[model samples]
Target: MNNSNQTLTIKEQLQACRSKEETFKTLVTLSKILQRLSSEEKTDENKVKGCESAVWLIVEESNGIRHFNADSDAKLMRGVLVAILSLVEGKAAKDIQQMNLKVELAELNLSSYLTSSRTNGVLAILSQLQQP
Candidate 1:
């Protein structure tokens, strides 16, 4: 087994949010945390394409593991982006692939907030990062 196999699962990390309000609140908090940061510090070569707005995601290998950094021009959307980005960041590619992100998002009750296309777009981003 790899070192990541011993780490907590994504679903476990997400145990903090039990409601949509809480999830959205968490997103807001994340926005505050990322408010002062620049788009330059986190630039991944394999950017997230196909977003309606300009969105960039940067992933770097640290000690052979991947860490994700993402940003978008849209304000609220960046919060949303961070929500997804925060979940998968620091996780290994293969471990991220094993997560049930759709279910996790739905549990957060964010499905109604996103159109089906945008939902698929987010999933696609995760899928892209999961690739070796």
Candidate 2:
């Protein structure tokens, strides 16, 4: 699904969560929906810096749309990556460039639940994805 619809679905699901543990469980479920990266795709070039856990992101563009595949050694980080990537995967580059991931994460109430370092790591991934 495209970002707008997928984002709403994520929001609704997260909003329905009653507690942090429940929220995390929901996130883990979302992570399961993401495709895992192949060993060949887990090179230095794809590695996301600043993360405490090893994380990789593979980006591909076609016909002006960007596609992202990501993975992380930590299960929670995997879910976090999926949550962040769902906003931009399969989206047009122009549209993605217009997005503010910080604000998006705030709207989702995710950043407040993460540690400062983890939030920084998330921002690091956002920085790479938003580069011109």
Each candidate's TM vs. the true structure?
0.66, 0.91
Give candidate 1's error at residue 101 in angstroms: 2.2
lDDT of 2 by residue, 18-131 (tens): 888888898888878777888999999999999888999888888888888899998888888777887787888878889987888776657546898897788899998887
Q: In model 2, which range of ten residues has the least summed lDDT? A: 1-10
In model 1, the clashing pairs are 44-58
lDDT (C-alpha, whole model) for all candidates: 0.59, 0.81
lDDT, candidate 1, 1-132, per-residue tens = 112331243234335667767666655655553433375554555456666655676667777678765666666557666556655667777777788876655554456457776766677666766777
> 31 in model 2: Cα distance from truth in Å?
1.3
Candidate 1, superposed: residue stretches over 4 Å from native: 1-26, 35-46
